[model samples]
Target: MKKVNIIYWSGTGNTEAMANAIAEGAKIDEVEVSLLAVNQASADHVVNSDVLALGCPSMGQEVLEEAEMEPFVESIESVVKGKKLALFGSYGWGDGEWMRNWVERMENCGAQLIDDEGLMANNEPDDEAITNCKELGEKLAKA
Candidate 1:
């Protein structure tokens, strides 16, 4: 079975909800899924997974959470090269510039993006957003 690990740092529970929905949607009979908060997810987890999903809400200045998510993302970059990756997040401000920049960085680092723009929700995710997140998960599971 393929193994997929979802690592996320969520503030205000918005991104966390997105992560959960993605996990639910990604499940497949031949796939195993593991979901972890940034603190619990180690660099090795990212390195070992067959497919990965990362999530974090936009923080001040439209950036990832500094204390955990940013550091976690950096730590996993080299290990994630050429890996199938998906990114999802929620933003309270800006026009998703953060996600655009993140996607560029992932591409530059040799990560294959599951979606062109990735996925983003403004603040709390509604039903449509949750469904999108789940679809993202299913895609990753197939990857």
Candidate 2:
């Protein structure tokens, strides 16, 4: 079975909801899923997983949560080379430039992103967005 890890940082729970939905979708594909807060996720888990789904909301002028997620991301830079990765997040504003930049950074680090990118807006997650999040998870599992 494929093992997938979802690591996320959420200030107001929107991104957490998205992460759970992603895991649910991956489960439909019979993938073993581990959902962890950014602080709870370890480098070993990331290195051992077949797929990685990373989530974080836009914070501080359209950037990643710096306290935990940033450090976790840095730690995975060398380990994630050639690994399948998916990025998802919620943004309050600023045109989702953060997600784009993040995806680009991961790509530059040699991690293969499964699709274009995943971004939801604000605090409310609509049905279509949730479905997209789930589909993203399913695709990552299949990849």
Candidate 3:
């Protein structure tokens, strides 16, 4: 079975909700999925997975959460080359620029993003955003 690891960091729980929804959608016959918080995950999880999904909210200045998510992202940079990746997050302000920048960074690192543009939700995700996240998860699983 193909293995998928979803790692995330959420400050206000919006991103965590997205992560759970993604996990729910990733459930399939041929795939095994694991959802973990950033503190409970390590680079090895990404290295060992057939698919990796990462979630984090857009923090100050439209950047990734610096405390844990940023460091975790940096840790996976070298290993993510050629890996299938999916990114999703929630934002309170701005035009989802953080997700765009993250997608670009992953692409530059050679990771194959399931969606060229990562998914984003403003504040708490509405029904549509959750559906989109699930779709992104399905794509990640199939990739």
Per-residue CA lDDT of model 2 for 29-88, tens digit only, reads 568999999878789988999998899998888889999989889988989999888999
Ranking by lDDT: 3, 1, 2
RMSD of each: 0.8, 1.2, 0.8
Report the error of model 2 at residue 113, Å: 0.4
Per-residue lDDT over 21-61 for candidate 3, one digit per residue giving the tens place of the 0 to 100 score = 89988898899999999999999999999999999998989
Work out the TM-score per prediction: 0.97, 0.94, 0.97
What is the per-residue lDDT of model 1 for residues 71-95, given as tens digits with 9 covering 90 to 100? 8898877887899999889998689
Positional deviation of residue 68's Cα in model 1 after best superposition, in angstroms: 0.5
Off by over 4 Å in 3: none
Whole-model lDDT, model 2: 0.86
Q: Which segments of model 2 are wrong by more than 4 Å?
A: none
For residue 8, give model 3's deviation from the true position in Å: 0.6
Best by lDDT: 3
TM-score (C-alpha) between model 2 and the true structure? 0.94
